[model samples]
Target: MKLLIVGATGTLGRQIARHALDKGYNVRCLVRNARKASFLKEWGAELVIGNLCKPETLLPALEGMEAIIDAASARATDAIKQVDWEGKVNLIQAAQKTGVNRYIFFSILNAEKHTDVPLMEIKHCTELFLAESGLNYTILRPSGFMQGLISQYAVPILDNQAVWITGASSAIAYMDTQDMAKFAIRALEVPETKNQTYPVVGTKAWTAEEIIQLCEKLSDKTAKISRIPLGLLRFLRGFTHFFQWTYNISERLAFAEVLASGKALTAPMEQVYEIFGLDSKETTTLESYLKEYFSRILKKLKELDYEKSKSKKKKKTPFKSSV
Candidate 1:
């Protein structure tokens, strides 16, 4: 089947495109920056230049596509109205115009539960539009990404600093983007998956302290943790909105607020596992994720240190004038 991956420039979208191609599906990526998509080209994905915020540019990308994976997201709050909300509405219209089969949308878990949150509210709006569009659609609400959490704390832990969180003792559900991409392809492969809304998550839920322990074990270093009280987080939620004209509530801050309220619970994994048998590798555990995350960071730091030492040596020998 021919598939179009929107937001193909993103990590999740790129993974879906690559996995689809590997499965022998005709994959086309709707991308804004063709220069950055050279890697996609090398992987045998057809790149179509278009912007989701602009409807006219979407026509070419939507034409002759069997399905669309809606993976687009705005980088900041300013573009949320345009990209996440309007962009998706535009894409759905174009897909209808082109007579597409299935529309697979990626939304975050707890989006429905936390409608007051700015990003979640926009995502909920898009989800509703897609459902009422009368098209064969599958909406995936995956929990927090493992990569996102790891990247956020890796530097702080490496620097021997506290990884401050607002979640306190609450548990968080972490899902790997690779697993999300795999399930998206499965939805395309299975006809019964159409018109369904799934809450995707990792195999287990973990508390902040549990995750810190895993990180400590992997890095062989003590990790300081500072968790903000839930009461303060609640106040910040309202306080940030009051001062919206001055300071923008960041994604991290927004997520911390959500977690502190104990909203980030693991999805119903048994139901998902019943349909698609669990592959241990894809449903990664917190321990495994931290180990790999730390290993990669250590390797990169070593490479940087090596480069610096080489530069220092070159500078030391450069005092002799070239004659």
Candidate 2:
């Protein structure tokens, strides 16, 4: 299949392109700067110049595409309405106009529950828009990425910095981007997955406290934890909500109340697994993932320490060279 992957430079998008290419699909990455995305070209993907914010530049790129995997979202520096809302709608329209067979959209888990959150609301809206666009679409709503947890929890705990978490008892079934990419590319071949929405989360759900403990066990380093009260997030959201310039700041606090609902961001994966022809056991778990990360980082740190000590010893020793 000829695939057009939008946001191909992003974490999830790159994984999708890799998986699709590996599956013998001809992959074309619609990137803003071909030079910046030259790595995709090296990986056997054809790179095309296109910007989501420029709707006029989308159609020619979408032309002759068999399928589209849209993983694009607004960055912290981007205007929320331009990219997430208008840009996405235009892309969907172009795909429909160009007769793209399958459309796969990556969305957030339980986005409807967080309507006040700018990105979540945009994702939910885009889901609805794609559903109504008269196209064969599959919406994969994945929970948090385990990759993100590396910096959020692992690095901080390892570096002995304050790992911030809300006081809410919220647990998330974080999925690996690589595994999630499998479900996405597999959706192209699964007839039943067309026009269906699946919550593609990990095998196990983990809370903030549980993850901290896991990091502690794996890295053997205690985490200096700081809890931000949900009330404070709510207050900040209210303070920033009405300001036009504070949308970016508001995005940070938007999910605060949603997660505080005492809900686990997880769903039954039995059906999703069966539909996507994926094994639940093969999914990466929080424990194994964290263990691998901490092991690698700690080893690197130890190697650095050894090198530093070795250099110090060399400097301390009088020149033993025959002079």
Candidate 3:
């Protein structure tokens, strides 16, 4: 089957493309940057340059495509509406016009119920639109991405320092991007998944504090986690508003609510495994993923240090006679 993968250059998108290629499917990646598209080409994917913001660019790419997996969107609420809602609408219209059969959408868990968060609310709107779009569709509402947590928490731990987080006690379900990609591929293959909304998560749930402890154990470092106060979180939310145009009032309010109410725990990982036969072994524990993520960060830090030292040596050199 032929497929079009939007946002194929991103973290999750890259994994999805690799998984699709492994399945021996003909994959076409719709990307904005040619350099990023080249990487997918090296991975054996046909690269198609397009922009989700401009629907006109997508119609040519959508031609002769059987399915479209939309991983494109702005994580902030304001951007979500513009890109997720409006972009999805544009793609659906183009798909309908082009006679595309299936559209797989990546949505966030608790989007409908969590109206206070701007991003979730916008996603909810997109889900609602898809439900009424009169097209065969599958929606996967994944909880917080496991990678997001690792990036947020593991950096400080690896540096032998504490990390400050808002909701340390909330036990949220996290899913690896690989697992989510497997589910997406399954949704593309399984007829039963069409017209349904599935929640994708990991085999277990973990609190932020627990995750911090796990990082400490994995790296053999003693790291403390300090919970930022609600008031401080609210202030930071507002502060972010000044700098973030697409993620303003609603997004800030939603972030504050998530921290205050601990709205992270909602989905279970069992359903994902049951539907796709994706065993728990496929999902790496938080500690394992964090170890690798931290290692990369440390490597970059070392490179930066080397560059600084080279610059210092050059500066220390006596001025040569440059006749």
Candidate 4:
């Protein structure tokens, strides 16, 4: 089947495109910048320049597409209403007009439960809109991404930098993007998955403190930690909306306020795995993923140090051999 991946330049979107191609599906990417997304082209995906905010450009991207994996999401610095709200409405309309099938939408886990949060409210609204659109749709509500934690927690700990965390009681079941990608492509083959909503999460839920402790053990370095209160984030969310330029700050602050609300973002996955016909053992665990990442990074750092030492030694040995 031919598939189109929206937001193909993003981390999860790229993973979805790769998994789709690996499964022998014709993959096309609806991208905003062809130059930035050139790697997708090299990986055998057809690229079409389009922006979700611009409704006029969506038809061309949606043309002749059999399936759509909408991984497109507003960034922290983006206009949430424009991209996540208005832009999504436009995409749904275009998909309907073009008669697209097998629409897969990625949403946040437990988004409906926290509609008071700005980002969660937007996601919940979009979920309702898509389900009511009369299209064959599957909604995937994924937990925090393991790949994201690498930069947010692991890297900072490795570098001995201050890691900012909030809501020590907050726990999240973070899944690997690659695993989530597998679920998306596999959904196409399962007719029962149509019009279904599944919460895709990891096997275990972990707290912020537990994650930091694990990072410290793996890196063998103590992390400099900075704690931010959820109340402060809530204040910033309202305060930053006063200016146009700072609106981006307000947009992302909503997420911080919600994620740090001492809530657990988790769901039962046995049914999800059974429906998708996947074995639980095949999923990537947080421990294994982090171990591999740290191993690779530490090896590279050692190689760099060895190369620098050799360079200095060569200079010191000098021209005596030539004379």
Number of the predicted model whose lDDT against the real structure is largest:
4
Which RMSD values do the candidates have, in order? 3.8, 2.2, 5.1, 2.2
**TM-scores for every predicted model:** 0.87, 0.95, 0.83, 0.95
Off by over 4 Å in 1: 167-169, 243-255, 277-282, 299-323
lDDT (tens digit, per residue) of candidate 2 on 1-323: 99999999988899999999999999999998888899899999999899988889999998889999998877778887889899999999899889999999999999998887878898999999999999999999987889989989988987889999888858889989999899989999999988899998998888989999999999888999898888888889889979979977787667666766679999999988987888888988888888888889889999999999999887855567786
lDDT of each: 0.80, 0.89, 0.79, 0.90
Runs in model 3 lying further than 4 Å from the true structure: 75-78, 167-169, 235-253, 291-323
Candidate 3, residues 1-323: lDDT per residue as tens digits? 99999888877888899999999989999987888579899989998888777889989999999998988776443365677678778888888888989999998877777776777777888888888888899999877678777557776777756787665356777778987898899998877788999888766678777787787776667887677776767776777767755356647565555745654565655766676666767677666677787677768888999999999887855778788
Report the poorest 10 consecutive residues by lDDT, candidate 4. 314-323
- Ranked by lDDT from best down, the candidates are 4, 2, 1, 3
- lDDT string, candidate 1, 235-287, tens digits: 77667666645234644356567776654477677777556555645577767
Put down candidate 4 lDDT per residue, 217-311, tens digits, no spaces.
Answer: 87888999899877788788889988889877776777777678787889999999999999999999898888888889889989999999999
Q: Which of 1 and 2 is ahead in lDDT? A: 2
